[model samples]
Target: MARVLVVDDDKNTLKFVRLHLEEEGYDVIEATDGRDALKKLKTLPCDIAVVDVMMPFMDGISLTKEIRNTYDIPIIILTAKDQIDDKAVGFEAGTDDYLTKPFETKELVFRIKALLRRYVDSESDNDPIRLGNILILHENYSIKIDTKTIKLPLKEFELLYLLAKNSQRVFSREQIIENVWDLDFEGDNRTVDVHIKRLRQRFSHLSVPFSIRTVRGVGYTLEMNQ
Candidate 1:
């Protein structure tokens, strides 16, 4: 089973999360603060971490940065519903995802599963994905089209990799946001549109065999040309 480290100063919150996560078949290790969490990390191997924004001694953002520096596991930050700035800081600190407080247990489970899948994919897939003349190197976060190699930002590379890995599969705007961003992304459909537009602009001049096509009211799909 996947071992999860859950850190929060509130005893009630920790109990609640532990109970629900344990019910979902996860091995949960609880810590009352960031210091305790680091102590636990020393002896325990955790698959992922769920950290709350508010904590004594060390806050979640600081702890996330420490974990990012030391561990390769994914982290999910828990924040208050209105603490938008916390989410931004958490992202900057290297959190893989965030869950707003007053969240459902099912949503937490979903995010954990999603992050695990992504973590595993990155660890296992070392070979570049090739589609005709286009090559996607996941490790380098770059793509090669014909003779030109372009390095992209983290999100752009993930978005392109998602679509290209599942070439010809249609993904709705909501689905794209959920997969590329997070399930709790505060942005709207236009975020996906902007990213899509940027990707198109980047490779518009190339003689590529695949195109990211918009499916009207449906969404976007990377269609391989015949």
Candidate 2:
């Protein structure tokens, strides 16, 4: 079951939400205030959070900002404030979705389900993947470098996408083959090396020289921070 954290100051509201979410087969964790929510977050294994904007100890906006500093978990802000600016502020503070108070339980459950589906489908968008000055837009399948578009081949894009999806994580040739090439690659790790070399050569003219670093004994890592 998917785990969820529900942070609200009102005891009655928390109890109501917890029971409903539990009935839906979700593991629900509870917090009375934003400060307590942050503490719970440190130890709890929650996939998503339902946070109320008006809390006694720390308020949801501040708590959301603090969580965003390290964690990229999905956050849904529950608030009585229905103004556009309030919603804008929530989003600015890294809220994934916003729901107004006096909401129906069915609507709440539907929103949570939709957000979770989107979150699961696009988990890699949170990663930053840089190739030279070119930035791969993981959420959009496009590339932009120095305000210009970089056309990538279909095969090359998949190769780069998989590497970028796990930035700084080294993968052997056999692993890359199984993932990107769909081959039983039993020969050598040099296949990965060749692709890395070609990717680097293609983007070498930028301010940040594009390159993939090779571990002395391991495999290749896509390192744009170099």
Candidate 3:
């Protein structure tokens, strides 16, 4: 059973989340604020954390920064702020997923399951796969080059993994959507473009000898310069 730490000042919100998660068979731990949550986590082992962005002391963003620096577990940001900028800041602070306020219990459960499946229960095969100079650790969903290691979000990591595994092979937009986001994704097809753009920018900063390129009308591909 996976232990989850949920941090929120709102008692009603905490109760609601705990109820659903406990019903799903998760061992739930609750905290009233980020400071309290951080103290608990250091002594208690948890698989993941569901955090709220606004709180009395040490907001979610600050807590996320501290967690990223010290903990390996994934974090899901639960905030009422649904703006793109807020979401981006959360991601920048190392959150793996984000959920807005006023969300359904089923949706919350699904996101938790999705993240756990991606990062925790991943049954990735070990095959010493190298894309250019970077090493792909499938099991950890991390990439390494020299002494540096990078952890990416689930979608960006999956897209990079798929393209890197295939090398020069191009994946169509529809195929990518079906593979990464799955069929139930209600978002428009343009989301793939958004992810691809992010992947390109991140990879570029690393000075990797590879590029994620658009195939015009076809889709996209990872081209390695060797």
Candidate 4:
């Protein structure tokens, strides 16, 4: 059974969510606030976390950032506000998905299952990906090149992993966006370009044996230097 961490200040909300999740055969962990959530995370391993935006001690955004920094688990942010800006803030804070308050427990369950499916599929292979001298560690979300270890933000790391894993295969901008970001991503195709640029900039000085090449009018591919 998958373990889920549900963090919210409202006792009723926690009970409501925990009940539904437990019904779905998930091992549920409850935290009244962000600080308490972090404490629970330290002791118990959770596959995913559902965090509310409003909480004492640490807000959901701050808690999400902290979790992203330390754990590889997916996060879903819940809020009463349905504003696009609010969602942008949640995504920026490293949340994999977002849910507004007064949501149906069934919808939340679907989202949880979807996120779990994606994460489990991505990690189905436990071996680290290697391209020439570059090592992509999916376990810790870090990369090793030669003697250097570099940590990238979650999105950047995922982008690089997708490209490197399918090296030499050209992925259209649409495909890249759909795979790296969610299908509901509000950003434009330029988002892919921006991430590609950052990845190139990050490794430009390194002695790597691969390159991310843009196929004019098509998309991008990671090419091994020959």
Q: Best candidate per TM-score, number?
A: 3
| Model 3: CA > 4 A from native | 81-85, 122-128, 171-175, 186-207, 214-219
lDDT per model, in order? 0.85, 0.71, 0.81, 0.85
Stronger candidate by TM-score (1 vs 2): 1
Q: Check candidate 2 and list the clashing pairs.
A: none
Clashes (backbone N, CA, C under 3 Å), per candidate, total 0, 0, 0, 0
Q: Which pairs clash inside model 4?
A: none
RMSD to the hidden true structure, all candidates: 7.0, 15.5, 3.2, 4.1
> Which tens-of-lDDT digit does each residue in 43-145 have in candidate 3?
9988889999988989998998888777877788887744545566676676767788888989988988887877765563645578667898878878998
Error of 2 at 178 (Å): 36
Encode model 2's per-residue lDDT on 26-119: one tens digit a residue. 9999998888988888999688889988889799899887776656567788878445455656655656566788777887888788767655
On lDDT, the stronger of 3 and 4 is: 4
Higher-scoring candidate on lDDT, 1 or 2: 1
Residue by residue across 114-215, what tens digits does model 1's lDDT show? 878766565565568999998998876678988898766445678899999888899999999888897667746766776787678878987888899999
Off by over 4 Å in 1: 122-179, 182-184, 187-226
lDDT of 3 at 114: 81
lDDT at residue 38 of model 3 (Cα atoms): 89
lDDT of 4 at 122: 46
Q: What is the TM-score of each predicted model, taking all chains together? A: 0.64, 0.57, 0.78, 0.72
